[model samples]
Target: MSGVPMSGAPAQPDPYAAPDPYAQPDPYGAPMSAPGGQPMSPGVASAPPYGQPMAGAPGQPGYPQDPYAQQQQWAGPVIPPTQGGGSKAWIWGALAGVVVVALMVGVVLYVTGGDDETPVADSSATPSEEVDPSTEPSEEAPDTELVTDPATGLSFAPMPEPWRDSTANYGVIGFYEVTGQVLDVLTFEDGSGWIATFVVGEINPSQLGSSSMTTDDAINALADLVDGAHYSKPPDFTEPLDGLERNEVEVNPLTVGSYSGSAMSYHLSWDDDSIEETGESIALGVLDMGDGRTAGFFLSLPDSVPDEHLDQMLEALDSLTFV
Candidate 1:
């Protein structure tokens, strides 16, 4: 038991043994994680694995060699760096942004229309001073010498001088005297020895279908004055009579101060001998006042009448106006 006797001595772990294959390499003398864990510096490539060629070195991965000559051999070709890959992406992104902005501006303009004043279209005739039909009187009324009627809506001038003035139903039908032989029935004979008269009145509603009456209707309504049985007298009478002669009569359309009416004429025959013995005639004017009303002037005169008397009668007829 001399050399082999070893029983209760302390077991000592060896400080130096075979190196560990999986342990980390030394920092000062070895690569030490390739200097901050980077393979190489900027523009510098790492040395290829132990047996591989170095970058950009002859007979390395970057440089090619001629296989038939003594030149060094290269493993493969390398690609050269170019502009950044993000350049195209940046250009496309800028174009897309411009399109979006333009679309936004167009939408804003369309919504607002960019105008403050809206256009208006006027499709009416020219404007004029309006005259109220219910309030304004007719033009026949002068400043001081005018008379107005409210019932029929008419205006009348004062009767002319040297002529008698008469009215039926308180001026409903006005009568102005003219040159002629005075009769008991309020009628006169003109210089031609024919009867003359004038009257104006609102048309009877029974005779009118509407407010507007035609000139023919107005003339026909007064037919009794010229061709009725009461006015018809034979041509062979010595004594004077108050009747219209049944002779040929002519009727025509006429205009009087914006009024349309009828003008009529006929020969008088009061004598009992011949139709032409009387040498007198009648002239009549009947005007339509447009609102179922009328104004008429009749003249009975010799074949030849004084110009002065005729002019005066005409002036009176021309003075009529309607409201």
Candidate 2:
């Protein structure tokens, strides 16, 4: 009021403030908000306020190091499948089956291979084609002279013709006797306890035992061939026999094939050796064959003959024949 009766200076507005229409109310350059506003992702780490830096910021270099650099890991290789072992086993089994079948076929071929056209060697010896034994039915009695024995109620006969009397061939049927080195044939007259002996031939050895068995069977087949038979295996012999008195001798299971033998000997008398000065006068035998058939030589002589001449009996036996 003193200096001229009115005001001299006037007041001015702030320079950074917005004008009335674009004005913001917050003090820290933030837009004006409600009382409690929060950030969108509150857990994420925020930038440093003014001067501090982040721990592993990509743009920075030469800071702390990472510990897991040289560690190793593994992965396996792939394999292709082969043929099944079971299939291989089946193939082998099939081959074996074929081999077995082939063997069986071979056996069949062998079995059926025999010749059907081969002819028999001797037709006379065949049983079905042979002469009948029961009734010889011939007027000619061959060379044998049949005689009836009063003591045994038996028949004694001589060998048929052609053979005569063999004094030489002593292998099969001979007339020779052996005393050490010397061999002679036994001879006898019609007088005394002598009986006649019939003679025949040297048959095949295979047929020998069978012939013996067959003849034995036939002889024993008759009820009166012998009263009884006594089976004996004397220790002195290498074999055994079934002594059927005057009927026959049975040496079964004899091994004509084996190197060894079961040999035996025996004597038979009808209670009459009165004129005898030596041992018992009877029928003595050495051996035949086995195979159920054999060759036999027999003689009826006085008991006065010495034992040393037994080989002579065998030698005489070598002269045996069945007419």
Candidate 3:
């Protein structure tokens, strides 16, 4: 009864009791104090919990406010606004360029003299002198005598002197008579035995036993007569000369006194027992006188005469004209 009789005495602790499951465990393996407990060390503050603000931070009560926090918040950089929706500096630059160009144009106009002056002519020259036409000398023409033939109604200027009409003495020297009416005969003797004769005539076809003949036919017939030695000797010869020679005849168209005709020119030479050897140049022509009428002419010149005399004879023939 001694061990079972402990009812009123204080219960002693149980050495083998299980611990309480609802109690908080100590984190640092030390016993935890109750709320309002004392710190483990003096004058050492505790750090805040993991994510809370501490005592002296920016919004809290103890420390001075942050120096950068009260300033204005920085959004970005600041830029000045433009006037007229563009830069004023560009407008000023353009105005300066225009002023410089105006100054350059003014300088160019001042350097060149500009187009405004009128031109004047020089006046120191002399005038030309006048001429007098009345004092000039006049030219005089050569002296000539124009003679008209009565039978053929033709006019001409004969040689100036020592040439005369010898028609009345026609057959006195034994020249062959032409087959026509003898109109005129001009004869010249140069005082040195040289002589020439020009004969003019109207052709008579009846004398040649023909009713009609052209001027060409008459000239051809005359040429054939001369060529056949019908008129072999010169005018002062009584009979036919020995050894007569005729050269080839040159026939040419001729103009005489406004009438067209033909002429035959040839040279004849002869050796006569009564005289020395001699030769003559002869030209014969036939002209149509119009209206069934015709004319003929003959010229004979000794080779001893100067050629100028022959030229004069031809000039006189050129001067012949119908009256």
Superposed model 1: Cα runs more than 4 Å off: 1-159, 167-195, 205-214, 229-250, 273-280, 288-307
Tens digits of per-residue lDDT for model 3, 32-122: 1111111111000111110111222111111111232111100000011233342222222222232223323432443443454675544
**What are the TM-scores, per candidate, against the unseen true structure?**
0.35, 0.21, 0.44
Better structure of 1 and 2 per TM-score: 1
**C-alpha lDDT of all candidate models, in order:** 0.31, 0.22, 0.36
Prediction 1 global C-alpha lDDT: 0.31
Give the TM-score (vs. native) of candidate 2: 0.21
Q: What C-alpha lDDT, on a 0 to 100 scale, does residue 24 get in candidate 1?
A: 31
Q: Which digits, one per residue and each the tens of the lDDT, describe model 1 over residues 1-323?
A: 01111112123421212233322322112211111122111011221110112223222211122122121111111111123421122222222232223323433543455575685655685766778897866566546443333333333343354333322211110111111111111111321111123334433322222223354544444444222211222232112334324454556655434555565555544433212222334455555554334555443433333334434444444444444
Candidate 3 local Cα displacement, residue 9, angstroms: 99
- On the 0 to 100 scale, the lDDT of residue 283 in model 1 is 50
Which tens-of-lDDT digit does each residue in 1-323 have in candidate 2? 01111111113421212233222222112221111111111001111100001112121111122122111000000011122311122222222232223323433443455365687677677466666877786676566443322211222232332213322211111101111011111221321111112222212212121222333232222111111111111221111123323322322211111111122122332221211111112222222323322232223222332334433333333322221
* lDDT (C-alpha) at residue 141 in model 1: 50
Candidate 3 residues lying further than 4 Å off, grouped into runs, are 1-143, 171-194, 223-239
Quantify how close model 3 is to the true structure by its C-alpha RMSD in Å: 81.6
Top lDDT prediction, candidate number: 3
Ranked candidates (lDDT, high to low): 3, 1, 2
